[model samples]
Target: MIGMYDDVVLSFSESKAEEAGMARSMTAFGRCSDIVGGKSITVELKSVNNRFLDCNSRVPRAYGAVEERIKPYLQSRGVVRGKVDVFVSVIRIDGGETELALDGEYLRRYIELLRQMRDEYGLRDDISVMTVAANRDIFTETESGATEQDTEDIMSVISRAVDTFIAMRIAEGENICRDLCKKLEHLGALVGEIEREEPRMNEAYRARLEAKLRAVLEGRGAGAPDEARIITECAIFADKVAVDEETVRLRSHLDAFGAALSSDDAVGRRLDFLVQEIGREINTIGSKVSDVHMTDTVVEMKSELERIREQVQNLE
Candidate 1:
């Protein structure tokens, strides 16, 4: 959802599960405006998910130095990763003066060139001050002096904007955390189902194998196959198809993911690693299982893990 408050726009996502306060999302926006030191300073910050911190800024040309400070200040405030854009607008409320000086020599040369063009092309002789003034290079504009106080006011507004930005990130992160937790619960349930189905699937496979062996022996008019040989084959089949190790590792990865979501520190990278590990286990199980029901269950688990991975990419 998106909302507007004065000049600031805020967007938040909704989730059905309970909110968790930990973690921070990389997508958010914040804006702040204030009148200070005879100037109206407004700072706006926008960020989106990125693998690394990329900060860019646009400020008044006279205050170009402020641009250099913005990125470092954001880093100091714990903004680790995102594509961040900073926009600043400063309007002087005080009666600040600007000096304009005419370039007499350039003006003379420009008029002379205009006359030459008119004579050469036989164009209308309609040169006037308004027309000549269109060449703004004939005038030099000297802006009022900038001071340290201006930089201070701009940084102050930016500080407030950063505070609001982080707050929004945290709020959105809470929704993400809640959604992730719900998905993790679903995945856990799927894993449990796979575990319960494993024994039955092995039993079914054993029964089919035994029936096939008995049919072959009867067709050849031979005595019944050795019982010990049948038992040994079934044991080998069960061992080959077992998913105990994969499921156990998968559960462990899920627990680590849940714990990372509860941490206050930056866990985006950690969460990504856990998701990859979980995917490896799921794929291993998928490869080992041949039962239709087990295959469908594994597919569902992969889908849920993918959802979690998408959310983790938006974290910082």
Candidate 2:
């Protein structure tokens, strides 16, 4: 088994992920900080596996304009699919304060509803200001809107974090690729063993059948049976038990698995499809072959394939 961090090389404390391979099933944390408009801004990015891109952001209300921009930025940085959560926090160098406001319309509606209930159901009219204040939505905490310079500063920090994040995923992916390739090699060897045992199985079956027939004929005081009929029977039996088609398809599937692993795009689904096809071929070979040695080889191949499948699940 390849250790989780075996392929990653971390060079600095600021980067969550460094130079390495890629994997879809991974978690990475990234953080970056910089000065913008004489204020210190820090950005953090957290990524986890998902079938599609789902990006969310947490920033000061004033910088809400950047929330919609986070996903595109990540996508541009090679985040094709994942559940990525970004947090951007700004600290004014001079310790600036935030603004606040009340939603007067919402408050008025709440008060009117309370009064209506009090009149209709004979409820107490003691709805104090404190009671209404319990609805946090009555007040909004506002911050200064992010200027063009502030946006650039924030994106710069986030880009650095995204770079580290992608590096970690790639490192993990490389580890998975190495493990999967080994399993495939072992599987191919097992397939070769099965191929070797196939001819022996046919010969063994024919010899056993002929011996049984000869014994029955001799016990019945009969002469030697026709050789041609015996040959025909053996041929038919061999044809029925042949694994030519299965082996051919299995080999093709193995090649496809290799190609998928080497692809630059997201190959997780493709690899999964190939694994299923390979397993199917193995099962077919198991059912068609009767030799104990061949059965054992099939079992071994299945084991290797299952391991490969496990690793493929971690890829994208």
Global Cα lDDT for candidate 2: 0.75
Question: Candidate 2 — worst ten consecutive residues by lDDT sum?
Answer: 12-21
Model 2: residue 248 alpha-carbon error in angstroms: 2.8
Q: Pick the candidate with the highest TM-score.
A: 1
What are the runs in model 1 whose C-alpha is more than 4 Å off? 1-21, 98-143, 214-224
Residue pairs with backbone overlap in model 2: 20-171, 21-170, 21-171, 22-169, 22-170, 22-173, 23-169
What clash pairs does model 1 have?
A: none
- Supply the TM-score for candidate 2: 0.75
Query: How far off is residue 170 in model 1, in Å?
Result: 0.4
Q: All candidates' TM-scores?
A: 0.78, 0.75
Model 2, C-alpha of 179: deviation from truth (Å): 1.5
